[model samples]
Target: MHKILVTGGAGFIGSNLSEELLRRNYKVRCLDNFATGHFKNIESLLANPNFELIVGDIRNIEDCQKAVDGVDYVLHEAALGSVPRSIKDPIMSNSVNVGGFLNMLVASRDAKVKRFIYAASSSTYGDSKTLPKVEDVIGKPLSPYAITKYVNELYADVFSKTYGLECIGLRYFNVFGRRQDPNGAYAAVIPLFVKQFMNHESPVINGDGEYSRDFTYVDNVIQMNILAMTTSNSDALNTVYNTAYGERTTLNQLVHSLKEILAEFDPEIGNVDIKYGSNRAGDIPHSLASIDKAKNLLGYNPEYSLRKGLEEAIKWYWENI
Candidate 1:
């Protein structure tokens, strides 16, 4: 069986990825410090014979090396996410997202992992006015969080060119779906909105409700990771691809869709008030991705649209916390 290492394996995306990888017959080792990740996500997986859990910080060099030992591939997803969170504590964001990421990269290279795939964010697009963000051209980093992700890409590129480490970066745009925690102050828009609508409370729109996003689903991210790790093409190596739905939806439309769908569970949900507030500091006005590269290169055909993903997310939020 192929062996794989997943950093941040207890977080939202990492947990889902680990499950999918194990289901596909890969031996999986999950490494997490449980800083932002939760043990509950991997509790059942610990029972599986194919899965091993390493409770250690990515910041520690020895921990990183031990996790990567005997693994064939590395899925690097451990990071302090959220722009506002990074804005509040840039040093914390940098330490994990940038510092820890480097540790994993060096360890993976030493372990001779076939491929190193890490999560990149649309925040790297920063202030670019372009409607659909492209890889070659990018704007300045808006927040400290964006800078760390961009630096990951840079270091990955250098590693590939210098040490022949094979790496692929997936630039995620507004990723939201099941297992996305909603209790934190830096909680994403979708889960936070779902939590509010679940309790018949008013949902707050950060801006005028005109701000938009690609809002890619987690399943699509899973597909991209699997495809990127298993691909045979040489040109596809050492590059970045946008993992998104390739369609944009405004916050107003999103809120209305959530309210309408949640009404199925409670009719009172339809009447939930939506409050408006000032736009966020680092928020981009509009975000849409050009997934053409991913389509042609990685066989990444997104199976879920925003509406489809929202339905699944609403169902999960309704069932889970």
Candidate 2:
């Protein structure tokens, strides 16, 4: 069985990936600083003999090296994630997302890991104005967060060429599901809206709610990472793939869906009012993804759509929150 090191393993996507790897009987090590990640996310996995946790920061090269040692694959998921937060503090975002990413790449290369699969972002597609964004076509970054993520791709490509280190970047769209944090100021829309409706508060819609996104589920992201790490196709290595469901949902549509779903749990949730606000800084109007590259090269087949994913997520939030 392959021993995989998952950076930010206590995070939403990393924890899910770690749990899945453990379920498949693979040895798993998690490296986390707990800046944004919570211990409760990976608490259940601690009891498993194959699961090991390293409480460390990716910004430190030694920590990255320690995590990469003896690991067959390195899944780098650590970063300060949020456009708003990045706008407020670009330096911190760059240090963690870019500097820390470079650290992990160097460590993984030294360790001779078979593959380095890191979480890239759709935000890299920034001002492109293209519908159903393709991997190769991108525009100038609109936010510091986008710039940092784009730098991850550039560095990964260079690492693969200069060091002959195998790397794959999963350019994820808006991913949401179980264990995703909803309390932070930078909480994702789905979880945040769900939380607001649960409290019977008016969920605010930014910019008349016309902005749309290809909201993906975390399970599909895990699938992409697994395929990227394990694929034998040489051409698939050192490339990026869109990790998304290939569908778009406007915020208005999204709010309506959430209300409908949550109403099943509490009938009065349908009556909760929705508020509108000015468009946020560093936010694009719409985002959609073309999953063709992933489908052709990685054999990617996403199992959940926005509605299906939201149903499951809402259930988890209802029971757990």
TM-score of each candidate? 0.99, 0.99
RMSD of each: 0.8, 0.6
Q: Write the per-residue lDDT of candidate 1 for residues 1-321, one digit (tens) a residue.
A: 889899999999999999999899899999999988898889889889999999999899999999999999999889999999999999999999989999998998888889999999999999898988887778988988999999999999999999999999999999999899988788898999899888888988887999999999999999999999999989899999999989989999989888888999899989889999999888888899999999999889999998898899889988888
Question: How much lDDT does each candidate structure score?
Answer: 0.92, 0.95
For 204-299, candidate 2 gives per-residue lDDT tens digits of 998999999999999999999999988999989999999999999999999999999999999999999999999999898899999999999999
Predicted model with the maximum lDDT: 2
**Ten-residue segment with the worst summed lDDT in candidate 1?**
131-140
List candidate 2 segments past 4 Å from native: none
* Superposition error at 12 for model 1 (Å): 0.3
Model 2: residue 131 alpha-carbon error in angstroms: 1.2
lDDT (0-100) at residue 99 of candidate 2?
92
Clashing pairs in model 1? none
